[model samples]
Target chain A: MDIKAYIDSGILELYVAGALSEKENKEVYDLMLQHPEILQEVLEIESAVIKLTSAAAQPSKTNIFSQIKEKLKFGNKEVKVVSIERTKYNWMTYTGWAAALVVGAGLLWTINQNNQLESAVTTAEIEKAYLEQQIEEAKTNLAATQNLLNVLRDREIISVPLAGQGNFATTYAKVYWDKKTNSIYLDAQGLPEAPEGKVYQVWSLTLDPLTPTSLGTIDDFNTDDNKIFAITNANESQAFGITLEPEGGSESPTMEQLYTLGVVASAP
Target chain B: MQLDTLVSQFQKKDEKAFEALYNMYSASMQGVIYNIVRDQDIAEEVMQDVFIKAWNNSASYAPEKGRFFTWILNIARNAAIDKTRSKAFKNSRKNLDAEYFVDILQTSESLEDTTDAIGIKKFVSKLAKKCIKVIELLYFKGFTQKEASEALDMPIGTIKTRNRNCIKELRTIVLE
Candidate 1:
């Protein structure tokens, strides 16, 4: 058989793409194992396609496997509960107590079973709510991400990379200043969590005279997953800075606590 | 072989193996779903459902029939297409034109984070229109050779050879 000719026929690409029929796929599978070159070619094609497709993907905000794991875990627990009930039923028939005691124990067992069943129903409800909540969250996150992408892609939006400063040199951030909307999207993904009673405050700066205007405190920094906050910035500023301040922020910019600073490249 | 082992373990209901496979292909599946549904939220819902369905129907899978990646890819494509056809989806999203996967790849925000960022950019920029359509139909859309032939208004044999050549170019661009 002419292996090179067979390979050139492009059957392997179709095979990897699953465009082949069952019989054709089986033949390709058999040939792949038989010939190292065929197997190698198939692997390469698959890898390249995987890379191409993955480049288009926007990954989920939360871990999807954990959700699957939770589902599988729930299934296993239900199975175990069923088996335990079966074993308990088998033991119930072997009971031999006096009539009165037996009645009393039976009532107690009934109550216990009823309580267990109630709790089981409650658990199932909770699980259902949790799953529903997760789906809702995923939907909201996706929508938010899409909106963020659109905003970032806007032609008029200016990108400012705020480098870490002073003692907080390890932390950094970015500001997407949209002049049209009078808003700046601050992406503080690189900043560490604000300590208790301390909130990160943003500021618009004037470079020549070295003046600053407070842009308010980030109270929900700990809760935001992306750490990208959109704050109204109507100021015609020259630079941007972030400072750690006590909760509710301070009157003036805390220059000593300034965590990051960046000069706007094309400040108007 | 490692993938084969992981797939076999996944077939045996091994969570670890399933997780490994999910991590490996979830991005690709998301990309495929995103390309079809074109809505990130709907795509996400379809992606989760696809994997859960794959896990539930794992026993029905046979290695001889096709590769595991191909199996999951089929599920993703079918699920996304099904979502588009759903009444709720239709009502919410009116008029979903047939868009190529190349558009998604080029305009994707997360492109830089992908391992194939540079190669993919180069490939898409350099790829001919014919190659894009062939790849979009055959690979991303899971179109059969005949369907792709009809879609591209080309012969089946040409579809096969063209897909082969396109993939060959892809290999050079991405796997080199």
Candidate 2:
């Protein structure tokens, strides 16, 4: 290859401009490596272009270098610090999880407390109802006892003991008459229970005239706890008699079925 | 020193070699950038960005492709052209194609401050109008031979030879 002709071809100027194709650039690079003259010529061409273009600058901007260095320094340091700070934030993440777990446990405990309070209230309510029922039963028993005490303590009451007669000789009864109040209380403690479909009726009698007046029947004779009953007496009764009758009381006493009889003693 | 060794050290994050490379080429790169952008501030800003880019991508360079000066020159020209195409540059300067680097060289007040400014002024003043357009397109604007040929309306052969002779004259005046 003729070196002078190659140098005069003007490809070297384009080579300095970086305008050559990549293959041509590589070929030129290889040639410059092989020949010192080609490399020297290329260098001279590059120098000329640099000087001409540099003339267009107003002045050399040598001061901007420090600013560029500063930017690089800040950028590198910021990246390093950001990574370190990110690692430090791991503790905050764990604390957040712990707080959530604590809140969950507190919520569960509160629910359990609510359930226990509700059951306790239910048990108290049941106990209160049972006590109320017992109070009602005691009140009934007290009223019955007071009625017995009042009958026994009356000043105008006359007590008469009726001995069992005839077929029911072993049966007995007593009558307490409160003539002022026009009431009589019959105590049939010694009497046997009447058969089914039968009741015991009381009678106020005047034995001189043999007249009988129906009092009332003992309807719940078998179930009475004290076997005592109160009946009204507006008659001028000389005696009292009891006889077995049908379920409801008869109009007059049954003489043949008289179970007990008693007479009131005058002024005694 | 070989440019490959300097670039290798630069890729290894050697700041001193990077600064050495910046000192050697930043002025020339600024001139090329200012030629297209036509503003000193914008030119300086683009020149700084170009060198930073060269440092960031230092490992991508290989000497078997071209000269290191040519590599950086290409980067400077591309950055300058990109600035001209930007919306801010176009909004501020509308008639960029009307002026060339020769006009900047002829009008520069800082020419006296440089060591070879007088020689560059004389060489640029005596440069043919065609030679100025050819070098402006080929080197400063990073145009290929065909593109420069098309822009100047000259034959490709004439563009290459004319550019060769123009650079030779420039060497005689400035590089001597």
Candidate 3:
């Protein structure tokens, strides 16, 4: 590569500006390492940026470092050196005193250990209470899951598969109807996310007259984890159907958006 | 005075080497900080914090990842930006976008005594409006190429090449 031309391309200036992506930065860093001229160019660019930026500074009012040093408590070199020596001797003296202190501390620690064990027993009891609370929560979740499973697997439930139609033929859905509970679980896993201002409406139907009844709309369609919705339905129906309606379901189904239809099979 | 050796010494808590490093970059750091904070006292305070932070985290500095100057510059920029974001700083300073770094350089009375003060003053006077916007976004405001492109309403390639030409012009004025 022509290093000068590469440098002249102005990438190194952006590199100094810290405007380059990490990958570009690493590449420039490697190239700078490989070529001295590239490195020199980067240095000059950095220097120029520095000069320009520094000119924005007001007059040197006071040395800021001295204030920082004072905050950090390293006032002078002589004082630091003297402090270092004092600390060195202080370490030896402290160690001797610490040894004696440790023996006395050991006895105190033994007494403290007994008290700590008592506290540990109390802590264990508190932990047991917390564990019990978690178990209660788990039991409630398990019960809820079991209720959902029973609703899905009940013999009274009628399973209806809704195949996609029109522009969304690839999508498929299922409905589990529990006539006893007047509840239907509409599994819309195959449907695309509803557009910003639209929603899917479920309809119950009578085949002879083509009478349609609106079951409430699927409101949390996007956020539903399994895209399975539970809706209340108590309609005497020969068939079931769905349609794409405006955000709130229409008074009647729009036949053009009739996405799926499943007729009731004759009983054996 | 190998760079690696000096850096290693500074890492090992050598105050003298740390001071040497400080002397080398302090002015540049102050400039970068001042560009962001645009207050001398606050910039100087942040500069001190940046160096102290560099000292404390000295072992984290790796030459392979970036230039030492770049690493320190990142630290200075981050600290200065953090200062600007503080409740007190934000409450006191309003309409930060009213001026750019070139305006600061052109109008600063304190920058008069510096060696390249005249050169920078002349460069700012002669700098094109486009150059000022590009440099302001890329260097002073630390905008990425894509961001600079969007801000300047130019293509990414143009931002890059224009920045290159701008810096080239600046180097001619200052480095000469």
Q: Against the true structure, what is each candidate's TM-score?
A: 0.55, 0.55, 0.54
Ranking by TM-score: 1, 2, 3
Best-to-worst lDDT order: 1, 2, 3
Error of 3 at A124 (Å): 99
Candidate 2: what lDDT? 0.84
Model 3 chain A is weakest, by summed lDDT over 10 consecutive residues, at: A75-84
Comparing 1 with 2 on lDDT, the higher-scoring candidate is: 1
Error of 1 at B133 (Å): 0.8
B15-127: candidate 1 lDDT, tens digit per residue: 77887899899999999998889888888778879989998999988988888889999999999999989998898886756588878777777777655787888889888
Residues A1-268 of candidate 1 have per-residue lDDT tens digits of: 7889999998888888889999999898898888999888888888988988888888575556556666567345432322345668766755644565889999999999999999999999999999999999999999989989998999889999999998999999999999999999999999999999999999999988988999999999999988999999999878999999999999888889999999899744
| Candidate achieving the largest TM-score | 1
User: Any residue pairs clashing in model 2, and if so which?
Assistant: none
Better of 1 and 3 by DockQ: 1
Q: Pick the candidate with the highest DockQ.
A: 1
Q: Residue-wise lDDT of candidate 2 within A22-112, one digit each (tens)?
A: 9989999999998899999998888877777777777644456766676567345332322335666866777888998999999999999
Q: Which of the two, 1 or 2, has more DockQ?
A: 1
